[model samples]
Target: MDLDLAQVRAFVLAAEESHFGRAAEALSISQQALSKRIARLEAGLGTALFRRTGHGVEPTGAGDRFLEPARRALAAADRAVAAALDERRPPRVDVWGHLYAPMRTLAQVAAGSGAPPLELGHGRDLPSVAAALLRGDIDAAFGRVHPPLPAGLTHRLVRLEPVDAVLSADHPLADEPALRPGQLRDSVLWTPAALHRLDFLHRFAERFGIRHHAEGTNLGLDGFLADVAADPRRFSLMPADVPLPDDPGIRSVPLVEPTPLYAWSLLWCGGNPRVDALLGALAAEAGRSRWLEYDPAEDWLPEPAGEPA
Candidate 1:
């Protein structure tokens, strides 16, 4: 019997999720489309693969028998594609949150001797990156991984970066050795985009009772930081390792007492050898730098999604 790989993939995801809606979501297709694919697949096999239940779906005896082989077929297809592309080519990687400089971590990884070459690109956010990963437009991406991640993609926490408050040099709290989240409750939480689009900053503001918020045009990091420096009332959070533009007008104050950590994770579709190499190199670098270190007693993290707390 001839079986379409797309149909096979849809069946596998549906079986894994046990819910057609979620399976469709993971495939980035409509529920109706997913159902049709599976229906066609079942017709080709001449048997029902699934049975509807109150919770979602359960595999029929045939489906239970087919599951492992379907997974192998998908993996083999991925390998064929990877082989055709040529393993010598660097893995194509994209990153989100460019405004915060995700490249710094990648650059650090690349700097290590014997690290594999990488072709880097930029993505707007997690959703966009997830789409690119699904489409095979890119092999992997780096950014903050949050919930509802597309089903086929997988991620691993790479770094936990402590954040600092960016303040104008003349701000009242500027000269303090360090500031706690509570210390900035009265200041405006400056952001480059609307709070809803800036998950990390929004959560930080909500967690700390920083009520005032201001949005500015994002010309780039330099322009954004310059705007932050222009007003003493404006403050923003940034990963401590991100280098500030040389301007005496602004200062980067470490957030202490309960420091907020920005979780960085490497996300990818499985079965890429290059991605495996990159992961290993990143792991070695993280170990050397203690990049994943976290002291829960003294640090604060957003509630765990897929990312490490």
Candidate 2:
């Protein structure tokens, strides 16, 4: 049966007021119109919803049963209208990343602006995070640089970092002030997905042709270090400034030959609310920091040049 909000309101008001004139007045409709609406509602429901009385109207059993459902329907309609109104403009987007220095910088940049609140997604690496972005699950990702970016995505490199090879402190190479790929040839490797820097590993492999055996396909932070501790010959290459436990048995050495570097970047699909606001915030911070877009050959600093003194 068909019934409108107006009919439901008429039913409610008429039931509450008991007097046709007062109910019609409260509903801003003529008494005749109110009565007709109630009659139409009763006919549609095929139930006598109210009993007329000398004092006021009272709901019949059916009317009492329908009251809560009607109220719920009305409330749901109200929420739908509000949500639609809020979505009248562009759709809000979600931004995601690991809480690292560069990402923290991006967050600060985005947060500093008084724009729509940036919704942040938590993840450890770029690919999984970027996968979500590409699947339309997220609007933007701020983590390790995304490569071979899918169509319809734009990636902008905000910063670049030289890398260091992490090894057990007791290892012989760790004692060397600084070493290169050749020196690490026989070392077993323990790279984590969260490390998210593929190019560096490839470059190291290309230069020295080191097997760099992986202890486990995917290992957590503690597991990774534990595996390395178990075998002192294992080493992992990671970003230069990222903090690691100061374990006496672990060491991080600067790799020299295929000295690797990775870009810090922001990636997004066009025209999403989250993407626009986040990109704007990132751009603003980039401006204030005088941060230049990364250009591998030209922008990358030599081994120690850009590293902290």
Specify the highest-lDDT model's number: 1
Residue-wise lDDT of candidate 2 within 212-275, one digit each (tens)?
A: 6663645445666666766778887767777777677788788664456655566765444445
Q: Give per-residue CA lDDT, model 1, range 165-270, as digits (tens).
A: 9998889999989998999999988899888888888889889999899998778998998998999998998889887789999999999989999988999876
Clashing pairs in 2: 18-57, 93-274, 169-249
Query: Model 1 clash tally?
Result: 0
What TM-scores do the predictions have?
A: 0.76, 0.55
Runs off by more than 4 Å, candidate 2: 1-116, 122-131, 145-147, 193-200, 217-219, 284-309
Give the local distance difference test score of model 2.
0.62
Q: lDDT of all the models against the reference?
A: 0.86, 0.62
TM-score of 1: 0.76
